[model samples]
Target: MPARAHKRFVLSDQPKKPVATAGGTFRGDAASFYLPDFCDSRAAFAIVLIAELTAIVLSIARQSAAVGFWGELARAALFLLWVGLVSAALLCWLRPRLARLGVGPGSVAALALLTLVVAAISACVSLLGHSRLVASAGTGAYFPRQLWPFVARNTVIGFVISAVALRYFYVTYQWRRNIEMRAAARVHALQARIRPHFLFNSMNTIASLTRSDPALAEQAVQDLADLFRASLSDRHQTITLAEELSIARTYQRVEQLRLGERLRVHWDVRGLPPDARVPGLMLQPLLENAIYHGIEPRPQGGTVTVTGERTAQLISLVVRNPLGERQAEREGNRVALANIRERLALLYGARALVKAGRFDEEYIVTLRFPYIASAPPAGGTRPAHAAPGSPEQ
Candidate 1:
């Protein structure tokens, strides 16, 4: 059967733009969300420099009323120029240099170097322009002391900004990782639902043939052993559909051996991507439910058909058994369907799905997942397997 496709991958946990001051977490400050203080330090520095220049212009205007507007306008123009030059040099120039600087660390060294460069650029251009403009304005003379103090004030602001920005980002990262770990753990716990039903069923099947056919009985025992071995291996908890199917087919063979022709099986398997993943032993219990509730009850015998197909962007897997009016009274079968649906939700969040109902005369269970033809290990560069060619548009 082909795998079902779903589109849950487009959703992301991170926000579009980082928030300042209160940090970027959607979680509120009332609950202790990490503060975006690191960039706040840099942002504070930027704000401080602008404030100092504004003050200087204000002071100049008071002394020479005619040049007030000119002083304010000049500061504004100079600040704009300072920002353009620093942004270009930091984002374009300094960042590329850091790559070669062998500054082996988180991009912190690049950020620090960029901050220092901005401070230098802002300090030089603003101070020089302030001095020349003040001297020419004729309201008062430009003094080194005056310009240096403002430059020093803004530089300190820049360093503070750096510290605040780093802190917020660092904490945000830690927060996200912890959430993912906890979520993964919860899903793993739900996986324990793979119960002893399969084991007991296998033993029962073997016992039915123990005296009737010794050779077939021996083969059933071996098959049951292999299925249990594969299922119980701690390292084998999660397996691809191909692997899971292999195990299921083995178990199904054991069932076939005991039940003989009374148990009919039909596979309408197509379109499944071999690289697709599934919960370990995800299908066995559902199959078992079909056998116990659908096949065994039919005195004349019937066929169980399993189908997998791609439905638009999602992968859909459906198991249909010969069920007619009997479906109305099959309480045990309904429980199996509910259990599988809960497991899908717990395992894949909203990405996975399950359903059970009557389609005409057949009782069916369908499951769907966002199709990832080939999904490698998370963050790893490997690819998932899909159909030989690309999927239909």
Candidate 2:
């Protein structure tokens, strides 16, 4: 919990990308839908097995043939199915908190209590509905007594499950931390590739104009300073879409200083959720890909367009660049898209994803992820990602 809170603290002031504040909620990508292996089916199945066996044992001990083998198994199966359904439903809300280790022992105990309540409700149904079968088998009177032991056993089982869940939380934290470190390293490498090369590229552009336009050369140097600083700031992994776009826009401005009449950028943002989130430094890398692979190769650079939208369940984003002449699939040099996709998978599970491809004359990449946001207060629309210009401070 401390670790998770610390992480939140670290990212507290970062910029928020496009998002919608539903009520007072701070909504973003569904990457928060990730859940680890704490909830195991085998364990749940075992709980049902014990409960039904207890019921059957009591029925037979009372000389009642009502709760036969199949009947007992059926009852157990139903109870467990109830548990599964309830947990699955709760996951939609609980998943985000769990991803960041926000769930604690108390939360686990509360869930246990809820499960127990459901269990009791199921017990009442069984008792009332099957009274005749139970009575004829001489087990009706002892059924309540049989329930006590299962209840007790189940309570202990719940505790065990909670303990396992805590362990899984720790394990997941470790796993996620490892992934973050690797991504940070990769981003660091990419930043290096950008700056030295980008600086040199800009310097060369300035050098070409130094003889004819000294004032423009000086302005280029200043733009280059702002560009490098903006490009290689804190080196964190996640950022709001707004922060990334802010940096991207700044970087593009710097590029314009160098590429005068060739580069163009347009935004098609009609579909943005207004509170979407994305990896920090994500856009810059892809933008670099656009500049280097597409624009640099062509003497007359093309346009880069960014589009974002939201469906009922997911946030969708696509970046399109118009520079695909030959289009031989360079299948292997796809680390940026690959790493980003991997991170999204680990963060969002299967619900959030990204895909990059090329068609006839354009290279495009798209991202789809579940939309998760902080809960909103009463009587308010969804909130923005955060304050702008306070760009991920």
Candidate 3:
């Protein structure tokens, strides 16, 4: 019995471009002074936990100097809690603006200013609380003498802690940015290798068709041009799903001309949003692999089935092709698969998956990733063609 399949298609009116978020505010417009937010929920939680632990340790160390150990512990806990709450509130209120201030000299100045503000506020609160306690104990307030020391100590500690935390976050942010750049450079190199190999094979196909079928060769050349045009375009920017599929189809057409009666393709795309963005050239390599490994070795070509499905949480694509009588898997296959896997890892981290295996005499590759809608370009206009001088071209 034949394998059952379903087909669906939904066209999009307008497809927006994807904005890369890996490097945060580090990429482009360096003249601007905005830096990305230094603290996420996890980082904030870690900061609070560390501060509390430090406070606890200090309180325990100074227990012999206090009237009672339990009383000292309670006082330490209260003081730390107050500090944590105030610091969190200040960060939540100011971090957004700081992010807009760009990571430059101006940003450093802003951070210093923020540190002073937080230190001043914490010192004032500490002095007020201490004065109230002194009054309640029937002792005249040590308004200037004792209170000044307490306030100055708290202020210095707050400034130092804030400076340290900010420095840690900035270092972490730079490390993450460096990782992303390295990954992107690796992917670009892999893509460069793949494009030349593809071009050589395509030229061979076009050469074979030139004499036997002039008109067909002309059409093939046009298709090749279009394919290369898109390939040469900005690869760092993601293209919409609709645009990607269109390129894939064009590539299939080019391959069909060379394979003739042997190559067959079936596309079953349903319920997928038009604005879904995927890495440029992502599908082409998979399809190339399908043709090279699954169909080329056999005298008679096999059918390549492409399926796409989208849900609220995820988008999935599957490509299946019949395996030949003999398996001729080579290092190139592994390299290509690894390349795709690395790209997926860099792009979506753990949220994206690429699985390839042989099942029931068919080679199948499935790609699953989180669903994210692309946002419209700044000018509200889409480019008609890929830019010239792109790496692929």
Cα RMSD (angstroms) for every candidate in the order listed: 14.4, 15.1, 15.1
What C-alpha lDDT, on a 0 to 100 scale, does residue 187 get in candidate 3? 71
Give all TM-scores, in the order shown: 0.47, 0.46, 0.54
Judged by lDDT, which candidate is best?
Answer: 3
Write candidate 2's Cα lDDT for 1-393 as tens digits.
Answer: 223322333332123211111111112223432244324566456545655665565445544355665665555556655654555445544555544543343346445654565566556645654578777887553344455565666556656654565556445644565566566655634634354677787778888878988987787777667666655665444555655566666677768877667778776654554445565556666776776667766777788887766667677777888764555554322756655554554445445556676777888877777765433446866434324221121
Better of 1 and 2 by TM-score: 1
How would you encode candidate 1's per-residue C-alpha lDDT over 1-393 as one tens digit per residue? 112212222122323322111111232222222322223357456545664665566566555444455565565445644553454345443433443432234246745664676567666755665575766876342322365666676567656755665565556755664565445544543454334665676678777678877788798888888777775664324566666566667767877865678888886655775556676666766677677667877887678887777667777788888784365666555555544444454345456766676677777888887665445568864332233323574
Clashes of 3: 6
Give the alpha carbon lDDT tens digit for every residue of 287-379 in model 3.
Answer: 888888888888878899998877666888899989977777556666666565555545665556677778999988888887676786787
Q: Which stretches of candidate 2 lie over 4 Å from their true place?
A: 1-196, 209-215, 270-275, 328-333, 343-349, 370-393
Q: Largest TM-score belongs to which candidate?
A: 3
By TM-score, rank the candidates, best first. 3, 1, 2
**327: Cα error in model 3, Å:** 2.9
